[model samples]
Target: MSRQMEKTPAFLTVVLYVLGFSLLMEWIKPLSQLTETGNFNVFIVFIGMAFFLYAVKAPRWIGIILKGVFILFSIHSLYFGESFFQLTWVIKLCEHVWQNTGLLFSDKLDSLSNEFRSLLFFVLLWLITYLLRYWMLVKRNMLLFFIMTVIYVCILDTFTRYDGSKAIVHSMAIGLILLGILFFQKIKEEGPFLSFPAHWVKWLIPFSIFVSAVLVFGYEMPKSKAILPDPGPFINSILASDRLNGPRGLEGLDMGLRENDTRLGGPFIGDNQVVFEAKVDSDQYWKVETKDTYTGKGWTSEDSKGNSFYTTGEMIWKLEEQGKDTSYGGQKSAFLIYQHPMPYLAYPYGIQSISSGLPNNFVLNDQTEKITPYESDTTHPTIVQYGINYVVPEYQKKELESTTAEGSKNEEDPKYLELPKSLPARVKKLAAQITKGDKNWYDKAVDIESYLQSGQFTYDKKNVAIPGKNQDYVDQFLFITKRGYCDNFSTSMVVLLRAAGVPARWVKGYAPGNYTNSTSDGTRTYQITNNDAHSWPEVWFPKDGWIPFEPTKGFFGQTIVHENVQGSLAEKEQKPLAPIQPKKPLKPQKDLLDNGSNAKIKAPSQSNMQKISSFVKNHKTSMIISVIFFAIVCLFLFLYRKKWMPFILIWLYRKKSGTETFAKAYLLLLKQLDQYGIKRKENQTLREYAVYVDSYFETGTMMMLTKQYEKYLYKGAEDLGDWKEYSELWENLIRKTAG
Candidate 1:
């Protein structure tokens, strides 16, 4: 006797399966909030469709076609913003997929477009749905997937901001029911057939009620705080590679003011805590300190070890020449109130003197130019408030541009020009390309600064990536990710400038913060928050000393860039200070390095045409080969589908013995026969189609198969013992289709 007397679960059990799987899918919704992953609703809909199709026992091919269509529609709606089934976005999607696939292999994950990324997500969902069907329906075992879902939801709840309380509740209620149903089915399959259903039902219902009641009681009970220490931070620390030399400090924390710069390039969350409030004459970047050394990953000060102590009343000049410079415009003072205490005081670039209410001596690191307050007992003092006197210089544009390499050669420091020996050569090559036509160091510096600010890089504090092992931070930011906060832009500019043989240093400080209120003395108070923490590059111009440049996108340095003037002293009075803004912040079509000194904005049509031309030029051979190979594979598959499908069906049903199995196998045979060109007409009955099939094959076996399938289909017959003898007939029919 064959094991063909199969019993499928009732409709209620199938509904339980769908509910359990749908609740499991609820875990995915929170990922959208936690990561860059978006359009989570599409995934939920797909999951529902998958479960619905499986619950109704739809044909496999029908389910596949429906899911594939929905995925295509989703991609069209989400990414393309075009009419459904339009060829335009389809072409665009194909191009994006091709380009991003190449980028993916090259480890440029951040560069992938939303379209291709969503496509990959759809593919993942497809796999997940199939797995769910196999585990829940085929094997009648969803315990592993249920446990995995719980773990996933719990982790997201703990590590991220996702609240999984409702999800857990849903999981528990649905999981218990699902597991109960599968357990019932399992016992039914294994136990003595005559007594199984009535005996199991008596125990199963009460056992389920007991489990659910206990769960409810436990859930409603008052819970105390966890006695165990949270190992989240410890686990995160361990997982985070110890790339930096010093303590991580504020680095990698969801706060501003990172102390250690030994490693950089990872994502960070923004902190809006107010660092300080400054009443200033004008918009100014509050300078904290400067780092000279670039150790591939991040900035470090090679010269901060030695600090010079200064009395509170004395003048501490930030400029090299102090009061003697003709470019020194006028005196300005800023009164700073510190909300967040730090060892160092944030002062302006051309600081003259620091005066405070409390009599505290200050210590200055000459190498980094960082000033810290100290007292009579040789201990550091907390700086609550202080007054800073500084000068805003009116740099002569002609003087700045006239200073050649030959002029500033003697003043150049090797330390400022130092780059890591392991630094990628592409950085230097890129710097050279950006500054190709620029004659003077000032223009070259401006060019490199402008290149960064030219809308190529994005200004993002969150979702910033940390450099992986053997990866250079600047290189990763410039060439790969192209998205970061001030540190990335500043570090990159300094690196590029250094690569181009220009003396530059990375300066960390605060940007000109939001204006809060105005005082009676005409001083504007700016509230500087932790979020206002910023960094930029300061290049050493021999004639003008160190001048700060803003390379970070969306930031405009409020300081002046002196434009070159024509004629002599008589015609050239003092030119008004112009705020340095990025010129032509357009996304260039060519390689970033190819954007030379003449970085003018191109017409959109021209840009698009150029892009097309460039893409064809670069990928012509690969595109041709890929298309041909894809076509060949598709043709091969289509031509031999009828030949291979029967083998697949035979393998699928080889170990199975059931009325449902016979039904499924018959449906598959009908599909195969359709593929085999013996198409069933729409008006024909099953018996008529069977007769036609039998007549075509010159056999009477299909008539017998049809009568048995009809009994299960209409009469709901469970025990179909004739399936044993007819199984050979089914196998013989399948084998005949292969020819």
Candidate 2:
């Protein structure tokens, strides 16, 4: 606290300030949660580093202490990395890279073998090593330089709204450069780099930086952007919630889908969405009807709009008690979060009752059990609830067992028997040919599914040459050309059956998602993808209500039996998966969000995130090795500082002292040089060195010494200056040789 202590240089004060600021900035905005603002905070890291560099540079005495701090912080930063999840999320990123990379990038994604996480640790190690060596000798003195840079960058990135603090930490390199400029003057022969003119040599680092930035940013952005599809469509949909469905709370998101037609107009891409996740209780083939009759590419519903049976308080439970539940079934209450308005909520087949989550204005036709979204204005995140009776076979079997065969409901409806005007004769003949003896409706539907899928048809997304592109897609799908995907197959079958007087309606929804092992919970989870999109049909049975009969062979037929498929399809068709994988299984952690509605049970929670991360930090051997390697490098430099002076000379010549080489030589040259005022051109040869030496000295004495220098030392190594003693001798030789 004395005057002497206070006068211990501004650098030390700066370094302390830098440390305080780094801690303060870290404290003010702890890099914990990675929300949008937090992610932008990463940009401020540069400014924090700058402050740290300034503080370290502010004091030249605590080189060892500062180095230790840097190492400690770097290690700590790595452990606290996920806290900065805006930057890196190793596990999540890895899984995504593993799953979708092949889909986004071409051979680049496929060719790279998936390496384990340990390889990532090696990468981190290499990065730290490179950063250390790179900044080791950078000249960074003018604090103004960094301050100006930080201000400019903050202003520029403000448009990104990433947060200005990011600019602060990133610009810390200015501090490092200033420190190197002020203190770390020693350098060495970088390469044949000495052969280049000094101006060109000085530009090397900046030039390399420019080249690297161009290749990485300019070229990379365009290429990577081209590889990925625009997320604009999906993003816009999320933003358009206000116009799509009026004020449905988030919970009603799931139940409003079937009511989508009545939705308020907005930019909505419906077909591409994964609307419903249908998983049946029994493994029996789950079917949905999407087409009652086929026009061209789409199907029309043959069922008429019956009386509105959906009174707000009328429970479906009361009716199912009187009527029959269709399939072998059991159920739990359906809890749907309807993000936006849609039309129908498909309960797993044999839904005994509808208790909650249906729309307020929805008019559910009594006979069809259909709910329709009738309004036009919109909002989002509608949360709805549904409590359906399980209607297990234990109770429903009596109804199904005693029921008579399903007579054709289509007989009463003219719309069901109406075929598209453009129906082909051959298709009609083929349909009649196939129906030769199959009077039973189930047998008839099965016959059609088999005939279409039995190598006679193929799945193709490409446009097919169907006659009458606007009408009767069935005739084209049947006899003329059978190569079609699910839409075509189901369309053809549904229309054909309806034309033959069997009641059917077009059903639009995703096929059952493939089951996967749950991570948090040990229950079965389904991985639904947009690829499972399809349109199928449901036919009305006499007392049974409805049954799903997918007429498409490529999709529905192949997915009918588990034994008939492999991998994901097998799991989807055959049975719910037995849980296998556990996320972070090593860390005993349980999610508190298990709301019991899912039927999944989560593992128990144990260590906090920080505690679990100790695995990397506690690697004693690696830490020891890093410390030893760093210390060993320092030791080698200490031992060889003298021998390496020549390399150091080359390195230092580019700094402020490089321009004023006389600073070091001035003191040592005393015993050697009689004259004081003298200088040398950076490009001067030995002869030129001697001549420039005569410029500021008494001409004759210095001139004579310079003349001899061309004769004695013109060849190669003589121009090099190593020890301060050698520099003094060179200066004296110039003076005395000239004198």
lDDT of each: 0.73, 0.43
* Superposed model 2: Cα runs more than 4 Å off: 1-236, 239-243, 246-297, 301-314, 317-331, 338-343, 355-362, 366-369, 373-387, 392-414, 463-471, 499-501, 517-523, 527-530, 556-739
Task: Summing lDDT over every window of 10 consecutive residues in candidate 2, give the lowest-scoring window.
Answer: 261-270
Error of 1 at 521 (Å): 3.4
Q: Count backbone clashes in candidate 2.
A: 88
Writing each residue's lDDT as its tens digit, candidate 2 over 454-503 gives 88776664334433313345655666566666656666676666655555
- Using Cα atoms with residue i matched to residue i, what is each candidate's TM-score against the true structure? 0.49, 0.38
Model 2 alpha-carbon miss at residue 616, Å: 42
Q: Stretches of candidate 1 above 4 Å error?
A: 1-253, 318-326, 376-378, 410-412, 564-739
Assess candidate 2 and give its lDDT: 0.43
Best by TM-score: 1
